[model samples]
Target: MKKKLGFLALLLVITMLVVSACGSKDEGKSKDSKNASGDEQIELEFWTMQLQPTFTDYINGIIKDFEGENPNIKIKWLDVPAADLSKKILSAVTTNTAPDVVNLNPTFASQLAELDALVNMDEAVSDEDKALYVKGAWEANNINGTTFAIPWYLSTSVTLNNKAIFEEAGLDPEKPATTYEEAAEYAKIIKEKTGKYGYFPSMDLSLVLQHMVMMGADLTNEDGTKAAFNSPEGLYAFEYFTKLYQDGLIPREALTGDQRSTIDMYQAGQVAFFDGSQFIVQVKENAPDLYANTIPSQAITGKSGKKTMSVQNVVVPKQTKHQEAAVKFALFLTNGKNQLEFSKLTPILPSNVEALADPYFTEAGDDAEPTDLVRIVSASQLDSAELLVPPMKNYDELRQAMYDAISASMLGEMTPQEALDQAEQEWNDILAK
Candidate 1:
């Protein structure tokens, strides 16, 4: 009887052990299922202009660091060619595959901002964050009081001189023309002395026109109801380009050449003085010896003596799912340290004033003086810069037409006034449509 009781207890112990093992397996299964409720990793898409080989490492390194810190989020970069940006972005948006963030021209930002395709960053950005950019920059991204983008980088038309050309013409190589008249006189001298094109009126008329508009033309008036381009101010700009071309200060090629070709001419030293982007730092880096003479440009004096600058902005697309992350990234990219890094790699100015004080400029080498030139250009953004025309709905088409008309006039197919008058009618009609 004792032996039988002992056997029963042993059987009970074995059964209990089997039950405990089963319970442990169930808990393991439960924990494995809980992964469904774990934090969902998010992915974001960002787009930027084409970068040269020199800047590839800097950009990729920044992105890699950001990803390391935020492993929960993944970033996919879409680099679009600067020339095909509009078409590519628009196609992507139209097809419902747009990037979460886009680095775009302020002109296009205004147009997209107008279409309600960008998120209003006003509520997302704090007053302190808002203070990061120069006064009118954020305002430039706002259309009708709605902020759609944040200023990313600043660019303005600045004069670049070939020191050799200046010396040959008996002009001061160190002191570039402070006024348009002075620039024109130097241009005249350059043409006569060297037989090279003295200057290239910006191939893009919008740049020159915007400066004229800011100087007081007001293409669209204060009321925003009337067109002002037919006024004396408008005609003044028309005459400026006409005079430059007709006076032989600029070559006939410039009348139809775009910014790329114009810059190419300047880099080749074929043009003595050229209006180019403020971002000469990257240019200097690319061709160290050639860019030795580049400097921060000031506004060419219009008959009115006013100066103006232009800015490019970063925008958050309306269709993005990662709005907060995109905003954070945009701010990070444009903040003091990063903006300075970008400015060093590219010729674009940092939108942040604090960045202007950074050692990148202070510790720059002789070969890197253009970095300081960029810093000076960045500092002038607040005092001298103004918004380009608010993006218009049919902007690309309208701009092409305007350029065509102006080019036709330059080719002697029409007069400047006639081209502008037709442009006014065409633009107003497009707006009405």
Candidate 2:
């Protein structure tokens, strides 16, 4: 599963110029004030999406420790409901009252960076600081070689197999497929032996872009001015889906449905494998028998031999008066120590290289839960993990274009190459605007 970030669209947009130099009186001097000793006391406002009562204690602790270290700077924390972030941020920037530091996902961060509303992190952070994070994690929100945010936490999928299904198919439960080719083989065996579908490749319709790239296909030209996924690699990715549908390897419903359909099939015990770790939680609650038969494993790679990651990031607004302090607190908030603590509270992996190297991520102990092994496997992938789709303009439209075209081919509405041609033209058309 992709990293879950709470975002509901009020207005699907973000952009604006930097606000004026100092905080205006109407904007509240509380954001910037002087202490009783006449020392400059800078209050930096921080905004995060949907991190409330659950993380209150942890965030408060970070703020307290940071304030203790940098007495002159105090953080004014605000938690915005995920659904309102887009509209509120767009409004905030337009109104010149944006927060000093904001937590965002790659999608929103990319949009803001495109408008120059966020800080240029590459210019603000030193190479030493950048080196502290995973190469892929840190670059998740880097658009056109310019970074606009600091990496916070990352999420990678863990493919969950049904042990009973595997054993019924005469496949060893202990040795699951590590790549899509092996997975297709397992699918054939499962369908032949057990009469159940193999796996759900199109868990997320948007993931078509990711899958194409994973299969060693480029989505765009050298300068990203034209679509390039109509090449041989792209044709192969399309043909993979079409072949599965035609051969009855995956569920026929997968051609018409998305992630929800995959979940439904898995919960009904009609599919052998699911493509994410979080799905097991639902299975445990909804389908106890399937949950009992669950075996968590690492995600399946495609031809590229790379793992995919989703990141949550932190960005400073270009208009913040406390640039240095805001940046320092952002850095402090995402440091290895703090990241390790957050990772414990959540199943997510740390972006920090040192934090990821902690024993907690590497060793789940002898009596570890199936999930513990899942985390360990996922952590191992971080070395190869990257934001495979990378941030692109009109990404939703691009994903939709690819999804629609590919799905049409899978349904025999068109040939695979024709599907790629249509998708490529649609993408180039969107990019042209």
Candidate 3:
């Protein structure tokens, strides 16, 4: 009886061991199955700068449509304030939590490219895909021959004139200035006749820089180590602006004022012309009476026939885990059809070449509003619009130095040559370190 009990206990022990092994194997298989299934799904995070409140519906619809077309991929969207984008992106990058894709202006995009934080789209984008965008817009994101981002929306400054003011000044409202010199001449006449300021150049922005580039001043040396704006072309640019200030063609406040001040002047009928993108909408909304007298004209061109183009672009980060999916979504977002749809909702112009060819952009109805005319005129200049400021790591500092020198020259603290030379020296010192 004792031997029989011992055998039964041994059998029970062996049986328990077999059962436990089987359970462990099954659990391992289950875990493997779950992982394999999870691997099939791809999630992407996307960020845009200050596009949320106004474009939430449109963007959400696009996301839904994209998910439907690509069932395996999911996108997580985040809208960041324009002012906080750079800081937010920097923090995300530092933590290795950067979004798969993000929207940024060319300036900020270039800064990241300099840091090697952005993917080189030139290597990833096909030639056929590259040809879809405007040449200038496409090139705007290219730094050191590597394209780091894809162009999305674009704008070029156009001359907006107060027709009533022009007429009162005895200038032909129908024939607006097409060149900077012509603009200056018109400014003199307007101020002389109507006793109102003619126009205020945007000193805070890149207007003066664009003018210099238009006059053939190279922004930097071949290696981008030092300032090249101190050349003869640079001197011409300085002298031109100095002459405008001395002659009182531009408002004195322009040397220090922001775009808001200029817009105020235009709205109050204190100025005849205001050079900007499709800002007529604001004028229409803020002062309907001023809108009635506003006329849109082609942007003032330099001898090069190139207008200053500013581009907003979408980029994929190098740290993204889902590069293929992220790039595909980016291309989808900026495709001709989608870009055209976005343009219809806002006054922005599309960077896609095919979108520009769309009838919506090409045609203006007989009863088109002043804003419509502005859009038409602005769109017409896209072909000739080139980015005046190329992507450089120290661009902001360089621009500030140039602005300071220009300000000094305008204030009579330094001659044009002296101001430019000092600015050039400062720029070289900044780049050296």
Clashing pairs for predicted structure model 1, backbone only: 180-301, 279-347
Worst 10 residues of 3 by lDDT: 25-34
Cα lDDT computed for each candidate against the true fold = 0.67, 0.82, 0.82
- Model 2, 16-66: lDDT tens per residue? 243343445355334456888888998889999998998999999999999
Q: Per-residue CA lDDT of candidate 1, range 1-433, in tens?
A: 1223323433443454345434533231111111244755667788887764666777787788787876666677777778777667665554445687888877666655665668898987889999988766777777777888888777655667777777877877788776666767878888888888777767564654554564456665554544567777776666667778877788776766567777678777788776665536546756577677665556465555444556677788766766788888788778888888887666666778788667654454565565566555445544665565665545554555666766666666778888778767776775565
Tell me the lDDT of model 1 at 292: 74
Can you write out model 3's per-residue Cα lDDT over 326-417, one digit (the tens) per residue? Answer: 89999999999899999988888999999999988778898888888877888988878888888876566677788999888988899999
Number of the top-ranking candidate, with lDDT as the measure: 2
Q: What TM-score should be assigned to candidate 3?
A: 0.90
lDDT comparing candidate 2 with the true structure:
0.82
Q: Rank candidates, TM-score, best first.
A: 2, 3, 1
